[model samples]
Target: MLARVAAAARVRPPERTGALLSATLVLSVGKGAFLATVMVYLLQIVGLTPLLATAGLTLWGAASAAVAVPTGLLVDRGRGRAVGSVAAVCAALLVPLSARVHTPWALLLVLCVAGGFDSAGNVVRRAMLAGAGGDSVKALAWARTVTNIGFALGALCSVRLLASRSPSAYETAYLLIGGGYLVMAACFATTSLGAGRRGSPSVRAPGVVGARSLRTGGALAAATGILTVHTTLLSTVLPLWVTRHASVPVSVLGWLVMLNSLIAVGGQLAVSRRAATREGALRCFRNSAVWTAGCCLLLGLVRFAPTGWQVVLLVAATIALTGGELLEAAGEWGLSAVLAAADEHGFYQSACVLGETTQGAAGPLLVAGLVTAAPVAGWIVLVAVLGAGRYIAGFTTPPPHKAIAIDS
Candidate 1:
């Protein structure tokens, strides 16, 4: 599958292939390290109560989102290098600061800054990749695959430390994350991205990437909005819901989440292969939605579980939702690549991320409000809403306009 994708999206390496590889490595390792361990570290070691932790996560979401607007504009304006480089520095500095902090308020502030720079750097990378022609999917996949692997690897390491009955080890995770950022920063600074100007800024690829003629901005905005709602329901409300009504302990929750992450890491490459067909991709996405929504519905039926099967039911539901996550990820990256024009690629991709961040920002707050409003199955209600949103977004796509390729 990997070889096929590489072949299908043949990589005619951009000038400075070596540099881009370094950039990919640095970005993946740097961001992946802390990004993976953050949630677990906060919940397990930082001793943040769920409420404060959600707030900190919200801070990260909002800041990351706020940065996307300017970062997108900057990338479109072709000022990516500096913005990208600065992002690395901010990420590096913030990781260590985050390591030392105990106060929820302080972590909130640090996450905001960290999220902003991290997102900005990512947007710049998207723009740079869009500018590289002839192998957009492969390039994007390579980058994503690496980051996914890094996150899994980094998170495993952090988990071991946190599991060792030594709270101080949590700090070690943060420092390691900082080191990743530092390495990424250095990689970006020294690498030569221009391979004799072959894929230079002056040259434009033939696709719907840069040109705004058939603008799918409206389609993208609507689709992204719906998808964002789904994120909130799953990430914020679902966990809280399990805490409230499910037959589970805090420790059980950790393992439950682990199940999802394990599936994601193990399945991403397998799922990436399904992108070869648009309808097939959508079918997978739809199936995930159906299963996720169905699972959400099934939570209400847990009282009917067989003897000692309550945990089994919850685990099953979680796996279904994660399956949806897998499909959504595949569709998102593939469609973003297909929809973007060379010049405008960064903006569109950032738009997708922005949509996610915005929804993420709202998720915790919304979940908080709902719990306050109605303690009975509030999370379940929210999950249903998200499932609805996902279903709506999937079906409401505007009719395709003559099968336009991203880079014509």
Candidate 2:
């Protein structure tokens, strides 16, 4: 009976892939709902002071970053599905608890725990995407496209909550977000694409094995970390730049953000196709550097432009930035998958996640400080930094013989 049950749990690759994407969609929507209304809910409904709220969020980021590598190490021990499902379930319970908490300490505790679970789930999911058969980059691209769509739909649904501005409305949104995480947990529980032990262990010591894996994958992780500054630039810096420096009305920021979403949703798959090979991935990185640098330059010049050209340049800059975003995502997915050892997906993925999470934790302060201190010079420095990072990333590419054979 146990053997039969185990066999039954082994889903086909196509079915597992579908489940993974469905899970991605669900998770994205939940995050979207939470992100769209979280600040207002915390400040107005819960009546927390801005400093407390910011501190709680900072703790959340810190917790997530702290747990990423450890969670990845656990996943490497043949527990990917179990670990991911458990993390999702924990998040499902913690999110609504967060909504109900009135005390500042409670809010901080709930967010810190939830953030750790969320980061663990993300690392396992990325590892699963790499292990999913046939064109990992393509699968990741589709998942990203679905994510954008889910976020858009979730945000649109939250409009009523934002409009009502009532405690009940915000609580209801949290309940729905929790429900989405429950569904995501179910998806992880049912899928087996990236689960289970690969084979017998190496004779080497565990510490040596882990250190070797990290050493092998460290360069790609650094490159990914450096590139993540673009996320900070787009989401935080650009909005502040437009509001403070450019003459455009604050209302224009919404359209610019929407344009970025539209471009990512439409172009990600096409861009990902170009990253199917090592050479192609490198090309994508180079292209991303060019597009991103151009975007910074254009946005920096917006203050000097006539009012008419300010909007025009803003739109153009957004388009360029979105293009860079698409290429960077595809290249990262390709390189991470190709460079990873067959049995060490979790280790390599966790390293990458550690890099990304560290950047996410520090990026806001770093980018905001630079941009606010010197708007024009900050943008110039960013352009140079991005260029330098891309150049360094090119040199980090392992020889073709070391590359994993990911099917196109």
Candidate 3:
């Protein structure tokens, strides 16, 4: 089965590839702009209290999570391109409205609906890539790299807006972001990528097959979810830990994040290539566990280090964490591709997204709370959990030859 799929896989034509990647870049730029400015806009311009802002964002996340599977189901039924384009357009229309919202209820409603559409757009994009049939992991890696570049550019643009401290500046940023989404919609609408297995006999009665695929994909997701904790640690816990405990200057945090992004942009493609096969993906997963564990240990010791060494250790730890991040991403993509039934890419992809969404939603508070309370012990607990997850992944992932047989 693996060989057969490989044989069937063909490189996308240059025009299609260009269109898809261009859309990804545009979407990511909008995402980056939104992330860089949304909180400040909500708090300063919109006059929401911190607690209300948090609650509204939480509701947005919930809406995204709630709609993921249903959007995926729609994609599986041959509507991926249509759904993606429409979702993008809807999000484009709704996001600018956020600039007009002053009340909590109005803000919450806008965010929730926009979040659902954004999440649906992402699900369709991933499903399209998965079903695209040729070196999909590498294709995704390129997309990731482009996304990072777009984000960096967008964030740079936001620095000017942030410095201006003008409400008009923020509103202008939102308008540009909405325009970006409109461009993304046009790209999706014009792309020629086929809807995989749509209307095929194999998918007609997807009930039993989808259930089985979901169970398998869900287990894969659960096993890998521990690795995703690193994301929260990178974005939220690390800066806080440094500020509160380590002697390292708070100013250094920005550089550390930049280093991670640089590494991801430079090395993600090479790492992804290594994980294009099942066995290679397993190895990547194992290596990621080791690197992440080392990172956790090094970070746990930061407070105890000499001031000069604190910076060194932090840099080293960031490098290690980035290594883990790169490998984990490649491994997950490879595993999902090999494990999913060819006709059920949307179902399996949805299961994977569900895991990521759940983790993203809950991880920050839990990780930040524990790490702040018991720094060393918290890191140790994380290492243990990650180790256990690695072991579970090894047990659950079918051997490559066996997976092929099952598919056959």
* lDDT tens digits, residue span 186-271, model 3: 87787777544466457446423444465567676676667777788798888887998887778999999999999998788779
- Any runs in candidate 3 off by more than 4 Å, and if so which? 1-15, 200-208, 399-408
| TM-scores of all candidate predictions against the true structure | 0.73, 0.90, 0.91
Error of model 3, residue 322, in angstroms:
0.3
Q: Could you give the candidate ranking by TM-score, starting with the highest?
A: 3, 2, 1
Residue range 68-123, candidate 1, lDDT tens digits:
85686666555666667789888878877887887878888998899898888777
Question: What is the Å distance of residue 202 in model 2 from its true position?
Answer: 6.5
Q: Highest TM-score, which number? A: 3
TM-score of 1: 0.73
Candidate 2 per-residue C-alpha lDDT over 1-408 given as tens digits, one digit per residue, 9 for 90 to 100: 999667645623333588888878987988988877887788888888998876777777788878877776666677788999999999999998888888878888999899899889888888888767678777777778888999988888878888898887777779889888888888878886763244525454332334435554676677777776767777788888888888889999999989999989878887888999877887786678788888889988998998889999999999999988898888887776776555566766776787677777778788788878998798889888888768767754755555333111
Alpha carbon deviation, residue 25, candidate 1 (Å): 6.3
